[model samples]
Target: TYIRHDSKDQFTGLLDKNGVEIYEGDIVKDADSGSYGAVVWSNDKHWGYLFDTRPDYGWSHPVKGFQRNYLEVTGNIHETLLEADNAKT
Candidate 1:
């Protein structure tokens, strides 16, 4: 998912393939998958999405930026699960 800031510097939703919403008012910036989730700014309100399953969120978290899948959205967390499975084995 790619993001672009408007003239006022307010972020806007460009496109979303992951079927996730990141912002409420406007989107400002976003992080790469490695960073975990992306950050969005909306009229002073900010939020983000969790790339992987975390304690904060059951599996994912709610954010203020538009979520994407093809471009730069974060992937689901699998390392933890993999570790657990490996341990069981």
Candidate 2:
């Protein structure tokens, strides 16, 4: 039996502001600005980097093109899970 998983993986052939390989599942963060979000793409608007950590946020904004070079990879969603577990102990 072929083990199948979520097929949400896709390469945008792009890199983050900090030279990090911005993959589909990467959770990007702006340390200096205290902002973060997952990377995704859309046919029209392209998730515009930094998915924002708020729902229906009023002041949420996308990472500017110039700011992309300043982004740092804190961790992806998978790694975040491990972090949460480690923090519990």
Candidate 3:
């Protein structure tokens, strides 16, 4: 089966602590803070990748500088949300 172009996410040109490529829609965990968030593109003036924790913690940070060092990809939003939904059912 063919997948829609929009269904695919863009790579952020960065890697997780485990050396996995970081991509939009990926759910990453902050080793220092032990918090999780999904990767998303920012539309603000900074205009780059953002580690969005708004859904769970009401805060976010740009995925630049030293922040990428502690990020580890635990899962993607699709599978993460699915697992959450299943847990609620």
Candidate 4:
């Protein structure tokens, strides 16, 4: 059987502090700043990978601003929503 991955989920060629691969849609946390956000591609003038802290408002920071070791992959947007909802209760 062939399992096809989503084309939107592209690897960012960087690893988290725990050696976890950081990919698009993967929620990550900054170990030092304690800020969490989703990894996404910036198609605007920046044109690179960025950490979108506010997906609803489009607030984000460039991945190049910090060291890869400062990032920690917590979960992914695809599977973490259920977990997040469960925590709200």
lDDT of candidates 1 onward, in order: 0.39, 0.58, 0.69, 0.68
Stretches off by above 4 angstroms in model 2 are 1-8, 42-44, 50-55, 58-65, 82-89
* lDDT tens digits, residue span 1-89, model 1: 33332344333354444444333232222444344443433233444443443456523344423344433433222333455799998
Higher-scoring candidate on TM-score, 3 or 4:
3
The lDDT ranking, best first, is 3, 4, 2, 1
1-89 per-residue lDDT for model 3 (tens digits): 11121358777788877778787888778898887877777655331334555556444477775777898887777776777999999
Score every model by TM-score: 0.23, 0.54, 0.68, 0.66
Q: How far out, in Å, is residue 79 in model 3?
A: 1.5
| Candidate 1 TM-score over all chains jointly | 0.23
Candidate that scores best on TM-score? 3
The true-versus-predicted C-alpha distance at residue 61 of model 1, in Å, is 8.7
Q: Between which residue pairs do clashes occur in model 4?
A: none
* Candidate 3 lDDT: 0.69
The C-alpha local distance difference test score for the whole of candidate 4 amounts to 0.68
Give the TM-score comparing model 4 with the true structure, all chains together. Answer: 0.66
In candidate 3, stretches whose alpha carbon ends up further than 4 angstroms from where it belongs are 1-7, 45-57, 84-89
Error of 2 at 72 (Å): 1.3
